[model samples]
Target: MRTARVQDLLGLLHGWYPPDQAEEWDNVGLQVGEATAAVEKLMIALDPSAAAVAAASAAGARLLVTHHPLLFKPLRRLTPDDPVGGVIWTAVRDGVAIAAAHTNLDVAADGLNRWLAARLDLLEAVPLQPAVGHLVKLAVFVPTAHAESVADALFAGGAGQIGAYDQCSFRVAGTGTFRPGPGTAPFIGEAGRREQVEEVRLETIVPQRRLPRVLEKMLKAHPYEEVAYDLVPLANELPGVGLGRIGRLAEPVALAAFAARVKAALGCSSLRLVGVPERTVAKVAVCGGSGAGLIHEARRRGAEVLVTGDVKYHEARLAEDLGIALLDAGHFATERLAVEELAERFRAGAAERGWRLDVVVFEGDRDPFVVY
Candidate 1:
């Protein structure tokens, strides 16, 4: 295995959480660095702050992957006085690349919200508001000899997946008739002569987000100069990828007891509860970071309580009116687990690919809000 580059690891990250899955308002993917930059070590953090940048550089890490993006809005100036500018200056000086997963990771199948729900032991959790991904059937006609190769390329480019299974494809053997036109260099048969050749129609299902890449790879692997393919849109919804999760605990626990469990599990310095202390609750909904927005959806999903961070006053009142409990676990505390989770996943990927890369989780960051 050769040295892993920034873009190489990015391929693995995007495979898990495609950038297109991010909310329209969110900016994800590479924020600051060249894609081809060599990376021997990677540091994962919750935020792309100056501290994270400095830590990565000091630790000799060439890449820094963060859950939060370094740049959100357009930059009007590039002075050191500005916070974002300072981070950029430090990163450029140290030659450390920065990339963000952001909302894409939030709404992925095995994402932050799912990890949070698992930590709390939410049994049989489903999305509070399901965000089904668009699916398409890609049918490509290839010569029988090259069908397997083309199918392999499509699978490598993020195609042929249904639920837990991958590399799924269907091939039908048939005879193809075609005639090469002028100035055309055909892989088989002579120009201006009608010919019939044995071919196989390879079909696979691809998420819309991966279609472009899948097509690119398939075209490259095809034997013909002009590949014959059909992309038919499907009405089927890709399941298990969305924001927030609604489920019940193994058994009912008092609202206050559940709150204590959350504090202990998340290691929060402090947390706020917006319901009666002794209220018995079984059904629960959980979302990491600022998920107060899911309160109504949770209620609709039959969750007796919603656990999330950054709950606004009106949202809390709405939860109250809806007869649901609210637990504000603090944004930093809720999202801090992303660093370790991403690091763990990246480590496994690197090892599987036989790359000698060090995956480090940044632990220097602290919650911005402090309690006296």
Candidate 2:
């Protein structure tokens, strides 16, 4: 049986939800274990609690993928007596690697918020606040014969990727002139002589997060001893990624009815609502976890009701004053739906890559809260 390495899974996860999309404070990506370690079985969960670790170990899983990261803060010690330290110790002892998707998964196009909207059958859903990132236009001068090779290297290093497209670039034939200074070893001409060579100007778009690796690959692949390149910053928003989402319902429904629909879809025992039951709502906005901060934005985007978790008393009051309905559907309940979805995605990706790996959803995990 062919075993998939930790790096392979990371590639698939990051390809769909790049870590750059995560908030500044989030700790994402591989938290424990080596990327080169072989993984034969993987488990997906919402949190990295002690029970989750034990369940993964019991199932003989080599990797534990979670929505929440274990190491949120810097650790001063690694003693098993501590809470976070105990989870770390258990994972290491059981030979289980740990990874997290976190805020990046929340912001992805196929992220938790999107799933929530789809579950409620929202119409014309769009991001409440679109994600903005630095984009750079990389222009590189390459020898005519080596343009294709250099472009290939840039693409491999994570450049030229736009929505649903890869290896996208533009090239123009041009001329290049260079004088190899003393002590310089030229790839095409004598060290002390002036050289005029036919070259191509290759231009491509790259995300700022990928600039370093792309430049490294470009330099390594260019034929010239002194590679010339220009990087210009662009002011543009990244497409298909953001925090929260707003959309309309196919038909208007009472606020109480919408709350009931949310409870049923999310498998919640009960949820808090902050509006009149008879109030009618057609436009809805949703954020997966702890999204009270987006209430004002939702209202600004014309959402009559906002469905999210972790709404404070004051925030709920504010929602009522703003004349928008608010639903607090427990943080765990709102986000846990992604566990099975993530497992299925990984399973399909593994099969496509011919990796003999078992993907399992950790049903042993549960909400920490209990209603008396």
Candidate 3:
């Protein structure tokens, strides 16, 4: 197996959830370490805390993938005193790379909220706040002899992906004509002479975020003085990519019973509930980590109950006013599942793709909240 770099491992996650999918206020993607650094072991965790960084270094993890970023706002200085900076310093000193998924992971199709829904056994779960996917159709003209190689380069560079299919492309034989001008080097034909050659019009789908890299690779693989390619923007309007999720239980259960199930499912030692215990809840919505702001959106989506964390007094009152049940699962408890989920996903994805990456879930994850 070939060695993978830190950037390569990061690309696997970003393929599913690009930083562009994150909210404008968020800072996703790399926080620490060099992209060219070779990586063999990866550590997954909910936060890029000091403990997580130390654990990664101790466990000999070359990279740390976390749900939350070590640095959100830009720091004016780097020191071991600042909590965020300390993590950064430790990662740098210990030679461990650090990257975050953040809102990108939160808004991904199979993101944190969807994982939470799956754990609760929610059926037909859909994003409460849905956003469409942005894609580009890449049409490139390549010499017939180089078509396959160029297509392979594009695929390796993060192009030609259309849900469960990869290395996908459409090709048609055609003749391309070009004139080599003075002081120009052409792959074929003499200067100042018009030439026609057999070519293939290759077309494929590429996520808008990966266009630059894909184009670069395609150009490198093409046997032409000047590569001809077109980037046509697409309106895929694909579902499943967004924040929060609304779904139904197999059957309706009393509010109290549902709360108990949620508390047990998420392993929350305590919960804050709004509305009477006898209220029946069949439709439920959830947003992992500080999703009380989505209560109205969930209600609008026909959700009788909203399960999330960090509910404030005002938010609870609004839920009551809206006649929807609310369950306050702590933010840590609600979003913590992503650690193990990401570890397992990376393990499977790496194995399938020959990444030679070893993933481990951080064991030091403990919700700051303690029940008295």
Candidate 3 global TM-score: 0.81
Cα deviation at 240, candidate 2, in Å, is 0.9
Alpha-carbon lDDT, every model: 0.91, 0.91, 0.89
Native-referenced Cα lDDT, model 2? 0.91
- List per-candidate RMSD values in Å: 3.1, 2.2, 3.8
Per TM-score, the best of the predicted structures is: 2
User: What is candidate 3's lDDT per residue for 150-252, written digit by digit as tens?
Assistant: 9899999988777678888899999999998999999999899999999999999988788889988888888888888898888775457888889999999
Which regions in candidate 1 have their CA more than 4 angstroms from the true location? Answer: 141-153, 170-202, 217-228
Candidate 3 Cα outliers beyond 4 Å, as residue runs? 1-3, 137-160, 165-204, 214-235, 353-357
Arranged by TM-score with the best first, the candidates are 2, 1, 3
Better of 1 and 3 by TM-score: 1
